[model samples]
Target chain A: MSEKIDFSHVRFLVVDTNRLMCQLVKDILMMLGCTQVTTARDSEKAIANLRAGGYDVLITEWNLKPRSGLELLDWMRTDGGSPDRMMPVIMLTANSEVEYVMESRDKGVTEFLAKPFTADGMYRRLVSVIARPRDFVSVKGYFGPDRRRQQIPFEGPDRRQQKPE
Target chain B: MRNKPQFIPNRGELKRKAVNYKTGMEIKLDEATLKKMEQLVENSSAEFLSETVASLKGLREALGRAATEPSARKEVLDHIREEAFQIKGMGGVFGYPLLTEFSKSLHDFLKELEDLDELQQEIVSIHVDTLYVVVSHKIKGSGGPLEAQLRASLKAAVDKAKPGTKPAQ
Candidate 1:
């Protein structure tokens, strides 16, 4: 699977305040054949870059200076500040608590990678976002990728049931 | 309800156009480049670890000052927590899972130090000292019995200091 996916043309934007972490993420992306990887030290710069458009993916740390990655995500998904609201976003964080994961999921994160992650783990996430692209669903108070990954056949009557006339 | 036309004349054309547009934008990975990347990640660990050690040393010095300076305690503790947070994130990546665990404990402990009492200050000092030992010694893998012993002692001290409260695990 790693061999088949070509990241040479994919443009990535990495957002993190830590210089070393940014360098590490950049190196990993460049190693995966990504030629253009732009990085921002904080959410403001990242948002400005996103507004300019052309990035195919965004990798951001959960904690950023002044504003958090979640706040940035919320702005992108709902504020109409972004050129592409459905852009693939991968969140990086050290907090592996279930609450954090759930919060990111609910906020419309495409993928979540816990820190101290391996190269293979990062690659897998890249592949998951690119190869298995999920359809975005936008309804009242909800807008993002389909949360459900597995589909089961429904043989019975319409389970939703018709609304009262 | 009236029956509607099942077919839309431009639907197939739209689908075909979408496919043609996507075919030109497909991403391709170069095998050679990926192999180079794997090697780079392997080689970068040592450099990363050394940098981490330097950062930890700086944090230790700050922690020492924060312990004694009451006026600057709040600001210094915040800085220490931020540094510890970074260590927590990168420690496991550089082959020091125990460092990550201990740093996380330290970060959590620092967060709960709003009203730094003398005993709380001592506990913070212990965490900083222990972290310095762990990072400087390059303690990889589990610390085994020694790790357990350290944790037990720290926990006992913290419990004694606070009373009716468990220390960060």
Candidate 2:
């Protein structure tokens, strides 16, 4: 049986240097019936809040003060002091190019929401993280959600032999 | 260091805690909620405009100081790039695509520059000025033909501003 997703209890930590952007995101989250939303202005403050705990997801910007959001995400995913490595991250920023998306994906971002985004877009991403979580993958020099999105079918015996890492 | 690959399934605590029987299974965006979000942005339009104006001022000031303050030029350029990047992001959301497009040029120009030359500084000034025009007039979306011409001119300026950038064919 399928399950219903609710947002009223999920805690969120939004990090952005821009006041308006942060407020806008907070307002949108509130509109979606999310009761617990917090905002931080920079990566440093974000890290502090994360360390303090109680956040289920992080929606951050690409540009931040003192340190960029990518740096914060790196720390979250790889740092020994990371609060929750599995916390979903949505990289929302003006960096909407393919390269930026690829970089964020490689860094373990759960979703990428480019700036000029719509309310529906934000809602969709939130639902995705809550309802469609990906399995985590850890390997040498990498740890993140599974990078592969598709599964291809191969008929007959396996064509390649592989040694386990 | 270990090379073993490990797969960990997501713990469904978030989902379990958020699940409700009355809400149903099929997920969909509520139109009324979206409308409310739009209204919220609309309510903040005035604030966005003022903040954008302030951002433009910040860009102009940083660019201005980069010329007079040699010792602080690097710091100033970094500030300008950050402010420009911010404008490039906010303008579109607040209904000023032209401003975003214009400042994107400024951001790109300074993105790789450790130091700026005379011509590059001029290019930065030009972009900041263009952003001012857009913010002041509240030019929404892509502007008219004149704005298009301005965009093309800025593109050419960015390309030629570099020492060895090839001319577009």
TM-score of each: 0.82, 0.88
**Residue pairs in clash, model 2:** none
* TM-score winner: 2
Cα lDDT tens digits, model 1, B1-169, are 1132121111222122222323322334346645565577657778877877787678767766766787777877788778878888988877788778877887777767765666766776777677767667777777688778767766766666665765557
Score each candidate by Cα lDDT.
0.73, 0.82
Best by DockQ: 2
Docking class of 1: acceptable
Lowest summed lDDT window (length 10), candidate 1 chain B: B1-10
DockQ of 2: 0.54
lDDT of 2 by residue, A18-50 (tens): 888999999888877788999999899999999
Q: In model 1, what is the error at residue B124, expressed in angstroms?
A: 2.0
Candidate 2's TM-score: 0.88
Writing each residue's lDDT as its tens digit, candidate 1 over A46-122 gives 99999888888899998887789998887777786677767778998887678989998988898999987876677
